[model samples]
Target: MTSDAQVLAAIINALGAPKKIPSHPPKYRRAAVAIIIRIRPDHGRSSAHSSKRRHRQQPQPQAQPRQQTSLSKQPPHAEQPSCLDEIVHPESLDEFFAQTWVQSGVFEILFIERANKRAGDHRWTGHVALPGGKQASPDEDDQETAARETAEEIGLDLADPALFRCVGQLDDRELWTSFGRDFLMVLAPFVYLQLTPKSPPLKPQPDQVASVHWQPLSLFLDRLAHPQWTPMVINLSNKLAPRISRTILRPLFGTMALHSIEMPYKPEFILRYQQELVKDTDMHEKAHPCSFSHSHPPYPPAKTRTVAMIDHYPDWDPGHRPLRLWGLTLQMVADLLELKDGPIQPDIRHKVWDSHRMRKRLDAGHLPGFSQADMHFWVRALLKFHSWQQTEKNKPSESNRVGSWESYYRMVKQAFVFVVLGRATAIAVLVRMLRAPMFRMIQSSVPSVRHSKLLK
Candidate 1:
């Protein structure tokens, strides 16, 4: 079995070479997140290669001369205040690495809670997200964008290649608009292996980050964490289904959230709102189907409906604490855990992945809360539902439909058994033929019964 460090190194190297820096860069607004890995000393022997070999494969950081000074001068906020630690001054990269290495198998990952959004902004505000934002003009590539964002959000410098190791990148993902009508911003997640023994004591930018969390990688792997699930309602349900994309972020982020089928439009909901509007009397004419007034402008009164539309998401609280981790952040953690295994493990992978694969129709706006396994079974159920609906539309008798489904299921079971029996028989014959000479001779003699019978 490969060590954790070896597996991570393999993943990074396997990410392949990134594309060249485009002149115009296609004008697509992009974002990038850094998945920083802090390698703890394994009790077993380490298989790390020389620094020279590793450095040769890594892309050199393009440092801006004035960035260090400019970042230091920014005014600090009163809330969630942070202080930058003394910079580590080392004689050489070797010295820096030597001082930073520690003897622990546990690794740490970082996440940030975003500050509350300003009013009227529909984007993800006051959400827990990875430390990243829209790519800036100065960013030469996605790597640079990730590095720059990390430095700005948390005072860690990626430009100094000696201080950090760029372990390649995960796939890119898209953050869509509130209505899911179009792509809000495209995100590219880059993985980094922190050379320092301890995680960087970050000075978070208060305006952007509400708080910083250095969560143990081991804690995530713990089955006890019991990642939570919450229902999310959005306009475009199908667009959010996790698709396997090479250029996009789907592969990298590795989908985790479970989505439900689009529900049929609720005419009753409209009626309820109309009744409430008429009760207020202010917009009573507007509420009536036939009543229309120029002054009213055919809009319901603001004080109309009293009920909330949707339920809160991230409902499954692992620790039942105030802090909750879900959605994209949780998905990224799941993907990182499977780095050594190669490709996301379906059985253990998120429900979003399986749901997206089985998804046929995209109609509903709300993703009802369901477990990873529930989503898997739901997908299979959906396949059956579609078949049933088609048959039902033809107005088949209840008894006939039941009989047909039962027969179909029985046939499937018999086919499976037949295939298993054939494969087993073939394996048994092959095994005897490949055995020792004595066994082979015995087999030939035993087969003499069949041989003679065939000859006769």
Candidate 2:
């Protein structure tokens, strides 16, 4: 078993030599996200206090004043210190990880659940995501954009060297709409490691962030120890609704299988205004007459209530439903974990779409919500589609440019046409073959109907 230090060392090394993707043309917007990592004492463990004491005995670095960056031009209140900074200026990341506290502590990554807002980008609303947004003007580079967004969204000043340091960066990713119809932006992910013993208290902006959470890194690295990943059935009909009506797409592509990990950490709600709204609701209920019998109990107090409505929207109640990590965020984590032969759980790693693998998995009953025969048929059809994609890759066309919007759009269009035609043809053929058997079975079951005037 690899120690956390060894794993983190590998990550640092991988990030140091990242395969960087150049920014696209000015037409494409750029965005950045910060993957904030920290090591905190496992309070649940008995040796937590002892570990802290041992950490204190180690040579402490002199605290230098945080340098003012362009991001610091914002209001002073945003930059106020919220936690004691126990900074460590290690000669190397290996030395940093070798610290007594780090070795004993639990590694954690920060995540924020976006508030469900009616306006703005509805695609990411109520999603468990990293603190980030589109790059604004005054930003020198993508890293600055990530830092500024992090501070604005969650009050975590990544620019503050006293509390955190930018360890390295991951490869850039191209954002696309469903079925790759349109290019949204290029997302550059930067990795930051907390220097303090305890993380600074986060003040999430209620309008943007619903809540903040720190999930243990172990959950992603070890699957057997923590079995959180489960199959999540996505309604493909809903995903295709923008292009085609759900009524038409429902029967063709009902659902698609994906994996999601249940978040274990309890979210600290940032929207304190919800409590006031809950209070108003309580007052309204008290004034109104009861619809039920007098014996029915009154509603719980606003203070006692576990859930509250905010902006006429229900906040993500973890108690009601566990927050699941999936989609792009999960993919980013997978990419980070796979760096330098890190101990990332095999199941969570990305797998290319292959017919043979699909068949093998289907036969072993690994894939749920799909029949063996249906998978076999679809896999065969997809093989042809895959071949076409390879052939196109070899050609010297403008659309052959990988990760370009035009190329992605072409592939999506081809896939859409292929899937629709294949499904329609398969359904038609099945119906035709079953038609004769159905007539024979019906005649045998209802002899009188066969000889009746209706049959004639």
Which prediction has the highest TM-score against the true structure? Answer: 2
lDDT tens string, model 1, 52-138? Answer: 334677798787677665645766652222222112554543443333132224466666667544547636554556777778889
Please identify model 1 stretches exceeding 4 Å from their true place.
Answer: 1-10, 17-27, 39-103, 117-126, 178-180, 224-320, 343-456
C-alpha TM-score for every candidate: 0.44, 0.64
Worst window of 10 by summed lDDT in candidate 1: 264-273
TM value for model 1: 0.44
Give the Å error, residue 412, model 2.
Answer: 8.6
Q: How accurate is candidate 2 locally (lDDT)?
A: 0.64
RMSD of 2: 13.6
- How big is the positional error of residue 74 in model 2, measured in Å on the Cα after superposition? 52
Local accuracy of candidate 2 as per-residue lDDT tens digits, 219-285: 7766423444377776656654565587776665656566667776466554544322344555646
Q: How many backbone clashes does candidate 2 have?
A: 0
